[model samples]
Target: MAGVFMISDHHFGHKSIIDFESRPFADADEMTETMIDRWNAVVGKDDKVFHLGDFSFLNREKTTAIVSRLNGYKTLILGNHDRGRSRAWWLETGFQEVSEYPIVYGGFFFLSHEPMYMNKHMPYVNIHGHIHGQKYEGNHYFNVCVEHWDYTPVAFEEIVRRVVPSEEQ
Candidate 1:
């Protein structure tokens, strides 16, 4: 089986993210197509992908359609923006979202959309995306949108070794 992966804040139909994020694509369609292509390139049919939040800017139908075209089964940790969309809407898109979760996989904590405030959960690194790669700092954090326009699902091990330091590891 392929390795598990996680990504977030792909604002797929938002043109402003290109400038705001210094994205490589010119527009939302180009961004979406490229993201899908890139995802398919690395992700296999059996690979599970966690999309933390902000999946799209368009309506639920458009968002769902785009998600359906992508590879892997997506588990969504819904963002504040997703609250407007009904639960049925998200379910139809084949993604699961929750307010707070404590799922342990890949030797890391998967808390989507927002990092925890307490340090008591030391070994449990919180993976989240809602700040859009700006003005945020904490322990064991990484942004997928930093060096690329397309989404790159980073493995927790990379984040731990690179950003968190060996002492923390």
Candidate 2:
């Protein structure tokens, strides 16, 4: 089976993100290239990647070019910064699917761009981004931002391992 991965808040071509997030890239171009290289290293052409949001801040042509260079069948869950754009715009950028609302995946994970509040009593967990370096309390919330991850897409199995006990797995 093709691997399933998740990532968020790439902010490609956004120079300020480097300063704001303290990303180690020298510039937007460098950040974009490094991120593409890192993404391709882990995600295969046939893999599915769920991008939680804020994929890029580049223009249409550049954004499309960057998206085309990445390896994966991409799905985007629109973030706050992703707004003010049409669905057609995102589709043209190469995302296979785009959603403005949260989606329940595998009947267990609630996927969204922004973190949702849920308690331990809830049966499902929220896998989201938008908080950047801010920490989310409790096991019910998992942040998939590039800052939280090693600036790469993470496998669903890894997320499961972090959230689920060995006995349950």
Top-scoring candidate (TM-score): 2
After superposition, candidate 2 runs with Cα above 4 Å error: none
For 1-169, candidate 2 gives per-residue lDDT tens digits of 8999999999988999999999999999888888999899999999999999999888899999999999989999999989878878999999999998998999899999999989779977899999998878878999999998878999999999998779978
- Tens digits of per-residue lDDT for model 1 on 91-151? 7876754433435556666556765454745665666677765634566555544233246
For all candidates, what are the clash counts? Answer: 0, 0
Q: List the residue pairs that clash in candidate 1.
A: none
Give the Cα error of residue 54 in candidate 2, in Å.
0.4
| Cα error, candidate 1, residue 119 (Å) | 3.1
